[model samples]
Target: MGTAQAATLAASLSRIVADPNDMVSLSDVLRQRQLIARMIEASQGEAPLQQVLNGAVHTAAQGCPAPMAKILEIDRTDDTLVLKSQCGMPAGAIGRTAGKAVEGNPAGEALKNAEPVIDIDVRRRPPESLPDILKDNNVVTSVSLPLINHDGPYGILEVDFPEPTQIGAFHISFLAVVAGVLADNIEKIHARAALIVERDAKAVLLREQQHRIRNNFQLIIAMVQRSVLQTTDDGCRKNLRDIERRVFAMASLYDHLLGLSVQAERADLGRYLSAMAASFDDFYALRTSGIALKIELQFGIDVDLDTCTTVGTIVNELVANSVEHAFGGSEGQITVSMTREADDLCAVTISDNGHGLPAAALESTGLRTVRLMLNGIGGRLDVQTAPERGVKWSILFSDTPPRKRGAAKP
Candidate 1:
């Protein structure tokens, strides 16, 4: 590969806990890599930001071979640098506001250039902040590496030496890699905090929105019920009653939702449908006398809100079909079941053991509604009916998106 291509590859590899830049010897590079690998394995994943900062500072002190190492966080609120972690110095000095982190000093120069700035023999050029500590400890050289990434500057990592010395390529590389790792972790911590705040805010708004939605649904049901009572036309009354039942089916879903699902609006499918089924039984208790409504629903099956509503509508329609038309004003049994047939398949079956239905009943408005709702949710229905035999309707749909579609991992 060309030099540009090789450099690009090396830069990408450096992000994986290893930096191959400015290596003076094979041993130096290997030691740097090994120390970084250990540091990452110890501090990765959900570690507190303070703990991570301490780990990075200690690792820098060890690998850079500095007598003292301290990390300062950029306090943008006051345009100051605050000591976060320190090793081989007074531990009580932590949390002290160290310096004005502007573009005048060696530390500020590193932050401004997004690189390392080295100053040796500090007797000639002493730093403004932390002067007493450096003088008492006879510190001579100070190397400052900016803790920065694509999100911009976070802080600075400073490694100071007691004796006058020229820091080598390996030490600078090690400090740079440590600063990069620390900066990345800092970014992740900030992003996670932001998301938590956003989620909490959304949850509050979501609860209020849900309450308003529930109230609206109840108002619609009540209005439909009032219309049912006022209308004298039998056909118009039946249609209005159907509307009331449909609205009730949607409203009653909130009752069976037990706990939180993977998604905010998701719920246990079987429990949700079972609750709706119980409500339906109660709604048609007079017509349902002497008839057994058996529900066999599978728990833990989850789907989105749209799928839940659409499938619930389809299930409600099919169950209503068997409850009203399958029996000739007599008594029988109705079985409603939902099951998971495969990793990505779901089936809902509603069957009834009653006198057979005429072909004209299958072509009624209820079946049309069932078909339409099923189509809306990417599902299909199959029916089996004959004279003296019962009626069975199975609705099948995939629980997962098609392979050709893009999907994110849960």
Candidate 2:
């Protein structure tokens, strides 16, 4: 503004302040406009969208001389202007949705023409018309301004007063500028949040891919070790080979989990357990020798991903041990069953009908792995072994104790 214009605005403000009863002078109006322009510049840099919208609603209603005001956003689903934030309306009338267009309502007219509608009585209009709550709140006249965005009409901003004659041109101008600022802020916030979500999802996928590569590397190590030991005549070397293979198989299963995406605090127990047991088959050529391993699953909803990995690792270790020691230098059958028990617990049992576990094997490293997995899932392990008969190892996990789901028990 020029110096002359600034001087004129100051003079007008002085006149209005001196005579409160008289209509505001041009200079007073210009001063209000200048203040609004300053506020706009101050708000330009950065602010949260919700904060801007709510602040604008409060500013237009309380900071201005106007009696009441609101920022309305269109609900695209319903094609109606719904109040997003408001001040000065009765609490019950704060969030009412304006009726559909038929004729004569200020909001409907503004919406239809994508322009401002000033000095209109909104009580009588189309289908269901104005809500009774608004009428009860003593709103006699309203001005509605459509909030336009890149996609076209977003919503409307409505200001209310006890009578139409009480509203001034300055008040309406200031509200229009405020509405634009609010719309821009909303768009910025929405775009930023969407970008964050997209980035996080991609990061998760990449991590899973890395895990699968690690598992493949472990499998290669186990295969090489098995190949070297199989050509040896020493019984001690064969035993060492079996131990190495089992450890490598365990590590491979952990790697396989990277490729698996378990949704929100829940894991696919069936797939996880199946994947772990299947890893052993990949390491040992048990299938070619007719020693078939079968899996039976009956996991319940409360069994999350953490529980699955723990239980899966335990099952893998037990089955591998059985194949190594119990088969009597020949092929044998292995059965794995999981079923939910009474009292919010899940039980997994691995059984084989071959040479049973001796007392000395109870404290073995393989059994320790089974016990650790069971404890991690808030459960315990019970081993039933009879010499020359068979062995049954059962794991029981309960929901009462909240334990980390995927970590193996110590």
The prediction achieving the highest lDDT against the true structure is: 1
Candidate 2 runs further than 4 Å off = 1-188, 191-198, 201-205, 208-212, 215-265, 279-282, 299-306, 399-410
Candidate 1 residue-wise lDDT, 1-410, digit = tens = 32322322233234333345634778767877888888787667788888887888788988877778888877878867778888888748787765566654666666666556778876775455444545665777888877764545657888988887877665766776777676667777777889989988887776666667767888998899889889999999978877877887777765443234313655667877888887766777834477788889998887766678777877776677677677877888889899998887799898988777788887777777677766666777788888878888888876654342233221
Name the top TM-score candidate.
1
The lDDT per prediction is: 0.72, 0.64
RMSD of 1: 6.9
Candidate 2 clash figure, as a count: 5
Q: List model 2 lDDT by residue over 1-410, tens digit each.
A: 32322322232222222225547568766765665565555556566665666666766665355678777666767666677777787676546776543245566666666666665555544425664535766666777766665566566677787765445555555665555555555666666779878877976776776666666657667675866657666766766665565556456455555655533455556555666667656666778655788789764434565665566666766777788788867778888888777767677889988789889888877667667656666678888889877899888776443653333354
Clash total of candidate 1: 0
Where does model 1 exceed 4 Å of error? 1-23, 33-55, 86-141, 148-154, 162-165, 168-170, 188-196, 254-267, 285-292, 303-306, 322-333, 341-345, 353-356, 375-378, 384-390, 402-410
> How does candidate 1 fare on TM-score?
0.72
Residue 87's lDDT in candidate 1: 88
